[model samples]
Target: MSVWEKIKEKTEAGERLSSEEGVYLFREADLHQLGQLADGVRERKVGKRASYVLNRYLNYSNICVLSCQFCAFARRKREPGTFELSVSEVVDGAKQAVALGATEIHIVGGLHPSLPYEFYLEMLRGLAGLEPRPMLKVFTAIEIRHLAERVAKKPMVEVLGDLQEAGLDSLTGGGAEIFDAGVRERICRGKESAEEWLEVHRTWHGMGGRSTATMLYGHVETAEQRVDHLQKLRGLQDETGGFTGFIPFAFEPSQTRLAELGKIRRASALEELRVIAASRLILDNFDHVTAYWISTGLPLAQVALSYGADDLHGTIGEEKIFHMAGAKTPVGQTRGNLERAIREAGREPVQRNTFYEAIRS
Candidate 1:
């Protein structure tokens, strides 16, 4: 059978594809054919509803210990422009986000090498104490690891348990650049290793915490490496069933060490669709796949719906990571705009909480 036929057969059988099949789907399948197959799988899982959210990104600090090659947001601690948000500052941002109709407050920031574990807990407490509390989705596994080792001086399990008690609703998959160690060494050396990253999330999941998984692609990584990354997440999801969604983020090479390589081009629209489709086919255990509108523009995000992406991420009222890395997409978009994007994609839009629970907007 042809590659397309094989993909369709496996998808119809509700079977996950092997890494070879994932690479084949990435290379051989036409965009439209891939979207059709992906849509079939999406229908089997989520039906015709396209999920989105009215959310906000609350970046607490820019000071970082790991000066990753591809990141433009993190700043060295001694840098003149480095800043950290006080507890009141974070609460102020959450208050504004809540008032603006944001149901979820997504928090991610640089790994503060000197901050105590209590400070991190206090950040969550401050947000949770808001008069009208928004769901606090905070921290990546890397940050958790940093806290455990440097701040808390305790085991990862203990650190995670403490954070959970503090008010962490879920984890946002940020620091996972790619699971391949070779690519990791070249791009982001000082950050947690691939196994450590997974182990942190795995420990969180074992504690009954839910989180998302992401793949940062379109960098020095190979197509096979991308497939390998997905396979790793897929295997983990099968084992723990902890991942709430899978996000495939294209590497933005603009203000980092990788950018010095050349004027890196964005991932082609076709490549974005293929990655989404293949992710859906490979990550059978993951229920939601997001097309992050902040990273990929609104038009491409809309197109991704047909290519196996069922979620449009969140509002991200003021996103800094992509903007710092030279993303031209607007910082904030209204619910009406998100709904129109879903409608244009020929799917119904549904607002969802951080855990993928339907939120009536």
Candidate 2:
């Protein structure tokens, strides 16, 4: 049989795809054929039940130390429009979200140069103290490492433990932009290495914690790099079994250095679907693959359901990172809006908690 046929047989038989096979599928497989194979995988995993969480996004501060070329969200300490929320301010925003039925508060921020380590613990404590107590899904691996190495002067495991004790539910998968060293240098020069990103997550998992994985594609990376990134996440999942989901989003170049240099354009909708489908096939062990609406917009996100995505992320009220990067989608969605989109796509919409457990059908 042909290589494509062999890959198809392996995929349908519930087997993992090799890195070369994944690269082949990304580069050579027909789109429709790829979608069909990915849909089959989605079916085997979750059937027609697509999921969303009643979540709110909170970026506590935008004043970052490092200036990643692809980031439009971070501002220098004294720059105009740079803002840092005090602990009470953050608590107030999270309180409002919790009152609006938010079950999860998705929090991430730039690596502020001067925020004390206690600031994070206090933020988590305040959020965890809410009457409704939304799940405190806070911080990316980059932030965690920063807190540990620079602010706290502690080890990663110790820092993660302290945060968990303060009610951190899971780490948000933001800083794993692209694992390729060339791509990393071009985009985010002063950021953590791929191994550091993976090591942070690995340490968390070793402590019996769960987190998500993400990749920022459609930038300078080639197809092989994308597959390599996926393989790295897949390998980590195989070792830890602690990942809750995978979210691969497109690069939003507007208002960033990349766009200023005129080196790249936004990823097309077709390319977005290709990544989603390929992600489903490549990360076989992951239970959820999110078609993040903030980057793709709701229309394409809806279409992604058929292209192997089984999650629509969340309501995500008041997103800043993507918007600052020129994402034009609505800042948030109603639960009704999400259900309608899922239903319109001929799938059942299930409201879920942080861990993909169904809360409502």
Candidate 3:
């Protein structure tokens, strides 16, 4: 059988696609064929309703010591743009987000070198203490690992336990840029290792907590490496089943250090759709694959809904990480905008919580 025939049959049979198949689909398969296969899988797994959350992205600080090359969001401790929101400030933000009908407060930030552990705990406490408290999906595993080893001098389990006690709802999936160690080092030197990232999610999964997984594409990774990242997440989800979904981020190279290298540029529209389709085809064990509208832009993001992405991510009341990295998409979108986008794509828009629980059908 032809390579395309074999993959088509495998997908039709509900069989998992191999890494070699993933590479072939990424490199040679017809884009429309891939989209059809992925859309079928999306329909079976999540039906016709595309999903999003009423959430706000809150970055508490930008003072990061890890000088990642692809990050324009982090600042050295004394840099001019460095800022840290106080507990009261975070509380006020959450209050405002809640006032706007937000059900979740998505929090992530730099690995601040000197913030006391109490700062994190109190931040969680403050968010959890708000009226009509929003679900607090805060901290990536890397940040959690930093809080454990560098800041608190404790085991990750203990650090996670403390944050859980203080009302952290789930983990974020920002740091898993690429699982290839060589690529990781080139783009982000001091970030968490693949093992550390997986272990954090595994540990959280054990505690009945949920998290998302992501990959930064079109930067310094190959097709095989992208499949490798997906396979690792798939294997772990097979073991623990804690990941709520998978998100694909298109590398925006305008302000990042890697942009100076003539080799780096924004991923082509075809490349973005291919990555979204490939992610859905390979991650048979994962339920949702997000188009992540903030990075992909609403137009292409709408196109992606039919390409196996069943989630548009969320309202993203305010997001600075991608903006600092030169994303032209706005920091937030309204429910009206989100719903209209879904309807325009000929899909029903379902409002969801952080866990993908449908709040409004």
Question: Candidate 3 residues 1-361, lDDT tens each?
Answer: 9989999899989998999998998899999989989999999998889999999888899999898898899999988899899988988998998999999999999999999999999999999998898998999888999999999999998888899889988899889999899998889997888998999999988888899999988887898999899999999999999999999998888888664533587898898999999899999999999998899999999999999999999898888999998899988999999899999999999999999989997
Top-lDDT structure, candidate number: 2
Q: Please give the distance, in angstroms, between residue 149's alpha carbon in candidate 1 and its true position after superposition.
A: 0.5
Q: What is the C-alpha lDDT of each candidate?
A: 0.86, 0.92, 0.91
Q: What lDDT would candidate 3 get against the real structure?
A: 0.91
Q: Candidate 3: misplaced stretches above 4 Å?
A: 259-263
lDDT of 2 by residue, 266-359 (tens): 8899889999999999999999999999989899999999999999999999999989988889999999999999999999999999988999
Q: Candidate 2: where are CA atoms >4 Å away? A: 259-261
Backbone-clash count (model 1):
0
The local lDDT score (0 to 100) that residue 302 gets in candidate 1 is 96
The TM-score measured for candidate 1 stands at 0.97
Name the better of 2 and 3 by lDDT: 2
TM-score of each: 0.97, 0.98, 0.98
Query: What residue runs in model 1 are displaced by over 4 Å at the alpha carbon?
Result: 259-263
Question: How do the residues 66-124 of candidate 1 rate in per-residue lDDT, one tens digit apiece?
Answer: 88888888998988768798888888989988988888889998988787777889989
